[model samples]
Target: ARPRVGYFYTGKTGSEIITEKLMKYKVETFQSMPIVVKEDDSAYDAISAMFLSDVGTLFAVDQDNNLVGVVSRKDLLRASIGNQGLQDIPVHIIMTRMPNVAVCYPDELLVEAANRLIDKQIDSLPVIERSNETGAKVVGRITKTTITKAFVELARNELM
Candidate 1:
């Protein structure tokens, strides 16, 4: 017995193209209600509060609402284990700062950008763009789950 590879005249599955084509499917931050916090806020309180609000991650923004950093559950857990007083510590002290953060544009093909997740071994990518006449800022986040679900849908559509 041997294996078979399904082949069609269409190229590259265009998962990238298909993903990009589905840009209309992109959901806005206001629609999803992203978790955001000021850098000066208490890391523990903000994280705990957002968690209670059903948010899995939090974005740290500056007074300009520019994305300055990000904090994940693991980061918060590590900080908490290291210092109980982190509850009062500012989020800036615990957040993953810029130059170290991972980001993706909302228009970027979900399939192409999904590779960054495995390559960087991260759970999500902050969706951002240059603020009008200013620095970059996070507008939202795209999680692994988002891309995975999108791909599954694409696959299903092909079958149909």
Candidate 2:
């Protein structure tokens, strides 16, 4: 016999409650592909990719595509506003270098990742996986937009 588990008694049907519970699902369920740049790449190139991708952040990767750092729009803006040539400045100069970047694992809860984003006061977290060679490999990205979209989808599903 299966162990009895107590669930909060709401007026809604069981299926409704189950669906509602799934809204707080794991990060892997909703993470999007990351926009990546190499550490040696130019600041101008990274900014261009950000504009094209419509994202506020970009993950800096090594030649092997292992996560090495994180760069934000603000970083690029700072670099550009200082009268420095963006095309010549490398992204690694302004990136939040590895061992300092906050990251999330693919298997963690989405809500937990959201909390980390808020607590860290950042716009996104690179979803990473342990690699035998590299310390960590960026697999995906979870952003505020991703969370909002997931919430909107769940609300729409609940309404239907």
Candidate 3:
């Protein structure tokens, strides 16, 4: 706001404003529908699903829709090129299983999720709802591309 003949200070720098907005972002705000494959599905099937859905990662799920593992494009490429048949090898065999997979929740801060993605050196993370008895349910996915888009949007926003 402007005064009759002077300007006022909000006490926040442009970088601070960007940080404030970025920190307020939640996983649910930018997460997209997740692509998934059954734990029993073959590596061949996973490759097909990944290509068909245009996703870099695929969540591995059980019959109850509980997250069992995560599969990356690199995992498939490495497993698929082996002499052994991909169709005969289950995705679970090539996936990063529970206790090793990185995940986020709908209410989690987007920055936290992005940090996990970078720290874990992964392209994507499953957004899940956890239940001690039922296991984590894969509800969405957050990718590096999505985080970059969010930052780009913030930079383009009217902040001055």
Candidate with maximal TM-score: 3
Q: Candidate 3 on 47-114: residue-level lDDT in tens?
A: 99998999999999999888999999999999978999999999999999998999999999999999
lDDT of each: 0.72, 0.88, 0.90
The lDDT of model 2 is: 0.88
In candidate 1, which residue ranges exceed 4 Å CA deviation? Answer: 1-33, 130-132, 158-160
Ranking by lDDT: 3, 2, 1
Deviation in Å, model 3, residue 81 alpha carbon? 2.3
Write one digit per residue (lDDT tens) for candidate 1, span 51-154: 68676678888999888888888878788787458767788888899979888775665554677878988877778864465766676777777766776766
Q: Highest lDDT, which number?
A: 3
Q: Write candidate 2's Cα lDDT for 1-160 as tens digits.
A: 4435775444688798866786558888879999999999999999999999999999999988888999998899999998779999999999999899999988888878888989999999999985577467888999999878877987787422
Clashes of each: 0, 0, 0
Candidate 1: which pairs clash? none
**What does the lDDT read for residue 2 in candidate 2?**
40
